[model samples]
Structures are given as structure tokens and as C-alpha cells.
Target: MCGIVAATAQRDVAPLLIAGLKALEYRGYDSAGLAVLQEGEIRRVREKGKVREMESQYLADPFPGGTGIAHTRWATHGVPNKVNAHPHIAGHVALVHNGIIENYASLRSELESRGHAFTSETDTEVMAALIGERLASGKSLLDAVSSVVHELEGAYAIAVISDKEPGRVIGARRGAPLLVGVGIGENFLGSDAQALIQVTNRMIYLEEHDVVEITRDRVRIFGQHGEAVERTIHESELSTDAVERGEYRHYMQKEIFEQPRAVADTLEARIGPHGVLPNIFGVNGDELLGKTKGLHIIACGTSYHAGLVAKYWIEDYARLPVNVEVASEYRYREAVVPDGTLFVAISQSGETADTLAAMRESRRRGYLGTLAICNVPESSVVREADLKLMTRAGPEIGVASTKAFTTQLAALGLLALQLARHRGLDDARYADLTAQLQSLPKKIEKALELEPQIVDLAEHLIHRQHALFLGRGAQYPVAMEGALKLKEISYIHAEAYAAGELKHGPLALVDEDMPVIAVAPNGPLLDKLKSNLQEVRARGGELLVFADGAASMDGNAARGSILRIDGGGDFIAPAVFTVPMQLLAYHVAVLRGTDVDQPRNLAKSVTVE
Candidate 1:
């Protein structure tokens, strides 16, 4: 992921650029830079650290200009450092970009033959140099940008500035987020809504091939052939407070408590007035439901865990064979998908690198249809899919991901229910499952009340060099997600193993110092899960369990520790149990004194491979 910001006004705009960069820091924090127009020349300031470091360097000299662009990069082509940062320039042509350039290798070789030299090791530098070459050869800024974009072969949203056209800027997008914000006497361009949210709520979101010309007092958008196009502007519904951490020490903790409302928003549109699951798409879904022979779910990281739970629900309810693949590794293995295969991709940011690549590969292989369940509307994944469902988790600022995971479960659970009905499996059994889905909001709210005990456990949190996550059935995925959260922010070496697999290899890692968090909810796998828990105890590993009160906790009652999410059945308990695990991870990271929101070496989106 990368963050981009630009401002064009009659007065100096470097201050706005700095503020915008801070707002978008959640997306990326590796290296940041800013470029401004000088007296008929281009001036730039950059550093290989957080936004704060770059801002401190800029405040000394302070390049004064009425127009500028800035970027914070997550880095894909090269390592994260000042020499590899964005805002790459060749003379007057400056470019700040987010997303990958797939054909950069071929282009770089061609540019070298033309007696042009490069400085930074980034694909974006090649793009900037290409534009500079075109502009030097008696071409206008608009034509130069359009010409270079035609030669590029992958996704990018680029904002270009030229000293020759002292008061203007040009922006273009193909497969990533780009927006233009309208202000009183200025205009803004950003890779995220937060970058321009404070300056102006009114924004025009760009689509593929849409090129925008920004000036001091006017913005003009056009198509490929210079045909003027009208832009659609909408008011942002998210409260600025939604992105703020109210009363909580961190945004992750606040988002953990917002799960009940988030899940409710996900279910609101799907539930009909008569308490029936309404059709998502008016006509496209029939083709999906009637012709689907089997289902394939693909994703990366936390979204992959959501797919893991979906595999169980789709098979148990609809009797359809389901295979879950990690998006990064999905297409590398040549696996056969039957005819009428429905490939489903799950992503929260929607710009995930491997997930988007896997979805593109699945489409080329003649899958019946591709579907995506994500949180951001109008994302690349949503535009590519045959069907789309947006998770209403609002803005998830935390890089560790709390509310997004819970909402993914809600949306996928609805999909499973709709699939079961189409397969003629929606009898009393199906209705019972829907009732449990309806009760999920309540169960999640009750689970949020367990924060006190979780915090108490956080105080006694084991600073283990290594740890283990144990579970079975649907809870197995829940355990994986727990371990992922713990490792992502806390930096503990945590691993998730199917509890049954404990005796195989991981049993060797268990010791008195290794704490095992067992996600053993009430289910058909309860007895087997508990037996696996005892196996860890026999090896001197400390046991911490999340059990169901309705189920028989007879033996586990006398065990090491209990944090009960007690209630609910196999169909909906996973979502309920997920809340407590999120809280536990948040508390543990706090105890460890780590950055909870912007975790080290991670970004909100994965725009490049």
C-alpha cells in the first residue's frame, strides 16, 4: 500500500500536504516525501522515515509553493529507504504514485538505451522519467501523461506536476484508489478519503482511464480522447470521529467494542421486513445460485481465515464441495476446478496484491463467475467480480484488523444461507441457523463484556519467545486469526495448529514457558479438542481456553484458565468467539508496549506483489 496527496491553490500548500500525509499514515509509513513548485523550478524534500521525520526536515528550508504532491510508501520494487522513496522526478516533471508497473523492466531497459539515467530503485521512477522524456520532446503535460500511461502494463494512480505549467497538475488512475477534493479556492488529490476529509468532504472518485486536470480554482476531468466527462461527487457518510479513538487508549480497542454495530450494518440490507434473506443482486445471483457446481474461496491473511469458516458453512448447509486457498499461493498450483465453479475472493482493503492476482488468474481459467466480499465500495476487487457485497465496518484504521474480520464472517454466513436455499436445503434446519445469525449481534455484545478478564490476563501476559494456538472445526480458523493478531502487533512467535496436529510436530515446542491459547468452543469437535488441550498440559504448557457455558465444561472447569464466550452453537459461535480473541490480542500488544494501530513493517493495503 502507498499513500498519495496533492494540493493546488493560490497560496502555499505544503502545510496541507503534511496534514494529509499524517491522515493517510495508516495506509503506509515506511518512507515519505513532498514536492512543490518553486520560482519556475521544482523543489523536493524527502526522508527515509515516518511522516514526522520528513515534516521535521521540510520545516527547516520549507519549499514555498502554491502547488505540491506528497507520498508515504509501503515499498514493493525496492527496499524501504530515502533513496527508494516516491516523488521521483526528472527536471520539472515530478510524479507521486500508488500501485505497481508490471512492464517496468522492459521499459527501464528501453529508457537506458535512449541515454537516460535513473537514480532510485523503483518502478515509479521509470514512470516519472518516461513522462519527463515525453514532455521534453515538445509535448504538453496532458499528452505526455496519456502517452506514457498507454505504454505501462499494470495498475497505478499517478499525480504529475510540471514547472513549465507552473499552476497546474495532472492525475490519472487505472486500478487503484484516487480522489479529487473540491475546496473554496483550492483542490486536493488523495489515495484515501482520510487524506482530504478535513479539507473538504465533497470529493470526486476517479474510475479507470479517468484523467483529471487540476488548477488553482478549477478541476477538469476527461476521457482517453480528450472528451470532457462529468464527475460524480458524494458526501462522505463516515463521521470524522469514526476514525478517532474515543475514550479508548487505541483505535484497535475502540473498533473491538464497535463489533455489534458493525455486524448489524452488514445484516441490515440482507434481512427483509418479513425476516427473510433478500436477494443480493436482482438477476446476476440467479445465474450464480442455479449454475454453481462447487465453490472456491481465496484470500490472504485475516481474510483467509474468514474463507476457512465459509468452507465449513457452504459444505454443511448446501452440500457443495468447497476448497479454501491462500490467495498468494492459489494459482501457482495447477488444481482442477469443476465446470460451473464459483470462485469467491475475500478482502477488506480490496487492493490486496495476491488476492487481486489470484482473482485475475481465476477469471482467465474460465470459472463460471467470480465473486468478492469486501469492505470498501467500488474497489478493484468489487469492479472485477460478477457479484459484490460490501462489509459496513466503516473505516478500519488499525493495521492489525479487528472489525473487518467479524464483518467478513457475517457477510459470508449470509452467502452460505442463500446458497443453501437455492440448493433446496432451507428447511427447519436452515431457519434455525438464520435465527442464530439474527442473535449474533447480541452474542457479540455479550462477548464484548469480557474485556475486564481479558485485560486481567493481559497484565499477567506471558512474554513467551514462542506460543501456540489450538482449536478444531470452525474454531480452527478462529485460532489462526488469534495467533495472527498476536504475532502481527505483539511480535511474539505464535503458530496456529489444528489441535489434533499437536502430537505430530508442535508438541515438541510446548513447554512451561510456552502459553497455548485454545479456542475450544462447544461443537461436535469439543471432546476431541479438549483431549488435545490435555496433551499440551501434559507437556507443561500453560492452558487458556474459551469455552461455551451451555456445553459440558466438566473437565476444563478445573484447568489452567477459562475465558468463556459461553453460548451459541456451531453455526454462529465462531463470530461470537472472534470478538474476545481480538480483545485479547489488543490487550497483549498494549502490555508489550507496541504500536497497536500502525504495526511495524505493515500497511493497510497491499497494492503490489
Candidate 2:
């Protein structure tokens, strides 16, 4: 994933571009750069690190211009360095791009044969060179970009600025995301709405193969066949404060603490005093979910783990068979989709490339329909799906997701309730489940209270090179999520396994040097999990358990430490248990002097396959 921000404004646009890049920093970038058309010349500034570094350079030596393009790059084609950073330039053309150019090597060869020289190892540079060549052949900037896109193969959202075409920027998207922000006297381009939200609340989400050209006060869009097209302008509901890390050291920390309110926001109006309301998904949600015989849930990374938890919830509560597939694998294989099986895609960004591809492929696999569970209302997955459910987690800026995961669980829990109703679940049990779902925010709040204990536990874990997370039944997914958080942020090598599988192979990795963390909720499997913990104790494995408040830790404290969570019921424990896992990872990452918000080699949204 990368970030792109471009603007054609009446005033100096350098500051706006920098600010937009800062807002999009969470998408994960190793380097930053910007190119501005100043005095009919393209001026460029690039940095090998954070956007703040480029901002500092801009503050010292300003690159003032009325039109500019900026980028924060997550390296794919080259090493992360100033030379390889974005704003790759060729002649008068300067550009920033997101996503891969599948046929860049051949394009590079062709360009070289035409006497074009290259400087950087980035495919973006090849694209810039190709556009420059087209311009040299007397093509307009828009024509250059639009025509070159036809020759390109693979996903990309690109913005180009030329010194010859001052006060204007050309942008195009195919298989990747790009949008336009409409302002009073300015227009903008960004990878997503957040990049331009600070400057404009009005946005136009571009569709596939749409090319747009923006000047100071005009925006023109073209369809795939070069025909003029119009797209609806949506007013963004996001405020600047939603992306700020208020009172918290990092975005991850703030998002972790915001889980309670986030879940409440997701559940707002969708639930009533009696149970989850019908048609919360959409007008036809009841009819589609009612006829569903089976489900195929597809996702990646943290969202994949959330789907795993949902498999447990839907099967246990709704009495339906569910299969959770990693979107990357499912997209490339021929899957056995039974009749009446609904395909559900889960994603925080809703633009995760693999998951979106999998959802598109499902349309040809004889599935009943597609349902999108996502946070972004205008994301591609939501726009394409037949049914939609918004997670309402707001903007999750942290590369390692916190609020998004919990809100997804809450939303999926409601889905389970809806399906259970169709299965003739008793009225009294439905009310009880609804009551527990309503009270989940308080349980999450109680779990957040365990941060101090988790902070203390981080001291013992920061120096450890490896860890093991254990859980049973539904909590197994919770354990997997915990391990993912630890490794993602703290760089600790962590793994998770079902507690009953200790005797298989994971047990051999446990020893005094490895810390074994378990989510021990007081449930049907509590005693069995305790037995598994004893196996760890026998091998002198250091134990750190996140246990229920009522669960006994009689002998556990003798050899280990216990952090208690006031888990009100087993039905909501997954969301509650998620808190300490996030807190521990945050604290450990802080202690290890790692990037808590943007972990190395990881991006917030996996937009590239």
C-alpha cells in the first residue's frame, strides 16, 4: 500500500500536499516525496523516511506552487531510499503511483530502445518516462496518461503533473483506488478520502478505468473507452479529529482505547431492546440471510482472523456451516461453492486487493450473493457487494488494527443473531443474547482496565525472542489475533495453537525462554485449557494468562502472572479478550523502541496482491 495526494489549487499547494500525506501516513510508507510546478518548472523534493522529514525540508526551503503531487511510498519495485522514493520524473512529467505495474520490465526495455534513460528502479519511473514520451509526440497531458494506461497491465492509481500543463493534474485508476475532492476554488486527488478531508469534505469516488483531470476550478472525468463520464460527489462524514492521536502516544494506543465507543457506534440503532433489528444490513438483508444455507467468509490478515471468530459464532449460534478462507488463496483456486452459499468478504479498509478480487471472482462461482462487512462506506468492496454492513470503526490509522477488529466482531455477532432468529431460536434466549451484545461495550471497557497489568507483563516479555498464545474453541481465533498483534508491532516471534493441540508439535517450542500467553475465559473449555497450561508449567515455560475475573488462577500465579478481564459471558469474550492482547503488544513495542503505529514491512491496507 502507498499514499497519493495531488492538488490544483488557487493558493500554494505544497502545504496542502504535505498535510494530506501526513493524514495518509498510516497506509504505511518507507519514503516520501513531492513535485510542484513552480514558475513553469517542475520542482521536486524527496526524502528517505517519514513525511515529517520532507515537511521539515519544505519548511526550510519552500517549494511554492499552485499545483503539485505528493506521495508516501511503500517499496515494491525498489529499495526504500531517497533515490527510489516517488515523484519519479521524466522530462516535464512528474508522477506518483500506487499498486504494481505487472509489465514494467517490458515497458522499460521498450523505453530504453527508444533512447529513454532511467534513474530509479521503480516502475513509477517507467510510467513517467512513457507519459513523457507521449507528450513529446504532441499528446496532451490527459491524452498521454489516458493512452499509456491502455498499454499498462496491472492495478494502479496514478497522478501526473507536467510543467507544460501548469495549474492542472491528471489522474487515473484501474484495479486500484483513486478519488477526487471538490473544493470551492480548488480540486484534489487522493488515494482515499482521508488524504483530502482536511481541505474538502466533498468527494467523488472514481470507478474502474476512470481518468480524471483537475484544474483550479474544474474537474473532468472520462470512462474506460474515452467517453466523458460523471460520478456522484459524496459528502465525507469524517472529521479531522477522527484521524488524530488525541491524548494517546500512538494511533494504535488511541484506537485500542477507543474500542468501547467504536463498538457502541457500530451497534447504534442496529440493535433494539429485544434483539438485533431486521434489515440492518440492507432493505433485502432479511430475504438474503433468510435463504442462506451456508457461508464462505473470505478476508486477509487481521480481517481474516475476525472471519475465523465469526465462523465460530455463526456455526454455534446460527447452526450453519461456515468456511473461512484466506482471500489470497481463494482467489486463485477453484472453490467448491455449494448452492445457496452466501459469499461474505470482511475487510477493515474494504480495499484489500486480494479480498476484493476474491469477492469479484465469487460472482462467477455460482454463489447466491455477496455481502461486504467493512468500515469504509465508499470502498470498492462495499460498492460492488450485493449487501453491506458498515463496522463504523471510523478511521483506523494504526497499521496493526485495534478498533476495527473489535467492531467487526460486534457486527458479526449481530449477524449471528439475525441468522439464529431464522433458525427459530427461543424468544427468551434471543433477548438474553441481545442483552449481552448490548452490554459488550462495558465488558470491553473492563478489559481496557487491565492495561496497567498488561503494561507490567510487557516488562517480562520485551526481551523474550519468542512467545506462544493459546486458546480453545472460539478463543482460538483470539489467540491467533494476539500472536499477530505481538509479531506485527513488537517484532516478537509469536505463534498460536489450539490448547488441545499442545501434544502435537507446538509444545516442543515451549520452554523457559519462551513466554506462553493464554486467553483463559471461564467457559466449557476452561478446565481443559487449564490442563494445557499445566503442561507449559511442567516444562518451566513462563506463563502470562489473560483470564476471566471469576476464573481461578490458584496455581497459575505461583509460576506465572494472571491479568483478569470481567468477561460478562462467553458469547462476548472474544471482543473483550482482544483488549489486553493489543495493550501488551503496544507496550512491548514501546519498550523495544519499535514503531507502534507503523510496524516495519507492514502496511495498513494490503492493496496490492
Candidate 3:
């Protein structure tokens, strides 16, 4: 993922660009840079680190200007360094771009033949050179960007500024997200609204292949057909408090603790004295599911894990055949697309490249309709989907997701209930499930109370080099999520297996030094899970069990470490059980002194495939 911000304002725009990049820092990047048009030239600064390093340089020697573009780069086509950072300059044009140029190889060869010299080994620089070449042909900045965009391929959200085109910035988007920030005596462009919310909340979300030209007092948008277009400017409701860590150590910790309110917010207004509300989903629920014969869930990373949990819920309740596939792999394979299958894509940030591409591929293969279960309201996936279910998790700043995952499950749970009700679920069952859904926020709060206990348990497993997680039925996906959290932040080698799969292979890795954590919720598989714990103990594995308070386990030498937390219920247990696991990973990473919020080699959003 990368971030881009551009501003043309009445006063100093370099500071605003810097602040905007700082806001977008949670998106993740290895290097940062900015280009400002001043005195008939584009002045630039690039640094190979977080935005703080660039800010320090700015403070020491400020790049003062009223029009500029900034970028935080997550390397894709080349090594991350000052040369490979963004705000790439060519001739008189300076540009910052997010997303890849798949045709860069051919374009670079053509440009080289045309005598355009390259400096950095980045696809972004190639676009800068192309745009600069177009400008060199005596074309205006707006026309040059419009003409060049028609010749480019793959996903890109780019902002360009040039000394030749003073007092203006040009932006274009296709596949990736770009928005124009409306401000008095100033107009801005950013990869997301969060970066510009402090400056102005009014935003214009550019549609795919739309080019925008912004000046101090004017903003014009052009469609791919070279026709002028008007995009609505909506006010963002996100406040500054959502992005701050008021009392928590890191955003991850803040997000983990905020799950109660987040889940509550997601459930608000959708449930009442009546059963699950109709049309809670953006589309008509009954009409959509009535024609849907099967379901396919596509996602990546934590969102994929959320889909895995929903598989159990939807199949058991809705009685529809469900297939969950990793979006990165699903798009590449020549997979089967059943007739009348409802395609659902899940992502916290709807800009996830693989999931978005998979959604497009599903449409090409002619699925009944596409649904996007995402957190952002105006994200690419939401805009493209036939139906949209907004996960009200707010802004998840942590690279390793916490509240986003739970809120997605909450949304998917609502979707499942909608399908089940359409399939003729009895009133008693519906009321019971609805009541449980209403109480979910309180149950999540109760789970959050176990953090101190989880932190204490973390002390036992902090020294672990390897760990094993086990669960049965619906809890199996929960086990996978726990393992993912452990490995993602703490750098511990962890694996999850269905309790029955222990004897199949993973049991051989069990030993006293390795910790085996089991999610043993009270259910039909409780007995089976207890036996799996026994197997681990017999193999000399140090065992930690997160079990229901009433679910008794005989404490032996290795079984003494039991984390007693309630499983809210069978339906909502996955969301409840996720809290302790998150706390464990957070505490272990804290003990290990790892970056709990920005973990190594990972970006908060994968905007590029």
C-alpha cells in the first residue's frame, strides 16, 4: 500500500502535505518524499524511512510552496531508497503515484527509444517521464494527464504538479482510490479522506478512469471519454479522535479495546423490537437471496479468515453451499463459477487489490450479483459492488487488524441471518438469534475484561519460539486467526489445526518447549477438544486452554495453564474468543519488544497485488 496527497492552497501547502502524509502513515510505507512547485522549478525531498525523518528534514530546511504533492511509498517494482521513493521528477513534471503499472516494461522501452532518460528503477518514474514528455509537446497539464492516462494500464491513483502549470494539481484514478478535498481558497487530493479530514471534510470520490484538475479555487473532473463530469462532494463523519490512541500503548491495543463500541456501533439501528431489519444490507435482502442459489466468499489475509468463519455460519443457518477462497489465488486460477452464485468480497479497506480484482473477475464470469462487505463507505469495492454492507468499524489504524476483523464477522452474521430468514427460519429461532446479536456488544465488553489475565498468561508463552493452536467446528477458524495474530506481530512460528488433524501430522512437532493453545468453547465438540488437549499433553507439550468458565478440565502437570473466558454463545463465540487471542499476541509482542502496531514487512492495506 502507498499514500498520496497533493494540495494547491492560498498559504504554505508543504506543511499541509506533510501533515496529510503523517495521517496516511498507518497505510504503511518504507520511504517518503514530496515535491513542491516554487520559482519556475519543482523542488523535491526524499527520505528512506517513516514520514518523521522527512518531517525532520523539512523542519531543518523547509521546502516552502503553495502547491505540491507528497507520497509514502511501499516498494513494488524496485528497492526502497531515496531514488526509488515517490514525487518522481522528470523535466518539469513532478508526480506521486499509488498502484502498479503492469505495462511499465514496454512503456519504458518505448520511452527510452524516444530519448527519455530514466533515473530511478520505479514504474512510477516511468509515468512521470511519460507525463513530462507529453507536457514537453506543448500540451497543458490537464490535457497531458488526460492523454497519458488513456495509454497506461493497470491500477493507479496519481497526482501531478508542474512548474509549467503553476497554481494547479492534476489527479487521476483507475482501480485504486483517489479523492478531491474541497476547501475554501484551496483544493486538495488524497488517497483517502482521513489525510484531508483535518483540513476539510468535504470529499469528491473520483470514479474509475476519471481525471481531475484542481486549482486554488476550481476543481474539474474529466471522464475517460474526455467529457466534463460532476462528482458529488460528501461530508466525512470521521473525527480526529478515531485516529488517536488516547490512553492505549498502540493503535492495535486501542483497537482491541475498542471492539465493544465498534461491534455495538455496527449493530446499531439494524436490530430492534422487530427481527433483523430488512434492507439492512444496501440491497433488498429478500430479493437478493431469493435468486441466489449458492455463495462464494473471496478475500485475503484477516478478511479471508473472517470468510472462513462465515462459511460455517451461512452453511449451517442458511443451508446454502458456500465456498471461501483466498482472493490472491482465486483470481489466478481458472476456478468454477456456479450459476446463480452470489459473490461476496470482504475487506476492511475496500481498496484491497486482490479482493477487488477477484470481484471484477467474478463479474466477468457472470455471477448473479456482487456484494462488498467492507468498512469504508466510498471505497472502490463498495462503489463497484451490486450490494454493499458497510462494516462500521471506523478507521482501523493498526497494520495487524483487530476491531476490523470482529466487525466484519458481525456484518457477515447479519448477512447470514438475512439469508436464513429468507429460507424460512422459525420465529423462535430468529428471536433467539436476534436477542443474542443485540447482547453481543456487552458480551464483547465482558471478553475485554480478560485482558489482564491474558497478559499474565502471555508471560508463560513469551519465550515461545513455536506454538500450536487447536479448535473444533466453528472455533477452528478462530484458532487460525489466533495463530495468524501470533505470527504476524510477535514473530513466533505458529500453526493451527483442527483438533482431529493433530494425530494426522502436527502432533509430531509438539514438545515441552512448544506451547499448544486450544480454543475449547462449550459445544458438541468439547469432548473431542479435551481429548485433543490430552494428546498434546501426552506428547509433552505445554498447553494453554481458553475454555468456557463452566467447561471443566482436569489440571495435570502440563494442563494447569487454563485461560477461563466465556464463549458468548455458539453463534457469537468466534467474535468473543478473538479478544483473548488478540490480547495474548499483543502482550507477547510487547514482551518481545516488537513493533505491535506497524509490524515488520507488512502494510496496513494491500492496495497493490
The C-alpha stretches of model 3 lying farther than 4 A from their native spots are: 556-560
Model 3 C-alpha lDDT per residue in residues 489-595, reported as the tens digit of each score: 99999999999999999989988798899998888888888888888888888888989876877753365488777776788888889889999999999999998
- Judging by lDDT, tell me the better candidate of 1 and 2: 2
- lDDT at 180 for candidate 1? 93
How many clashing pairs in candidate 3?
Answer: 0
CA-lDDT, candidates in order? 0.86, 0.93, 0.90
- Clashing residue pairs, backbone N/CA/C < 3 A, model 1: 549-566
| Candidate maximizing TM-score | 2
For each candidate in turn, give its C-alpha RMSD to the true structure in angstroms. Answer: 2.3, 1.1, 1.3
TM-score of 3: 0.98
Order of all candidates by TM-score, from best down to worst? 2, 3, 1
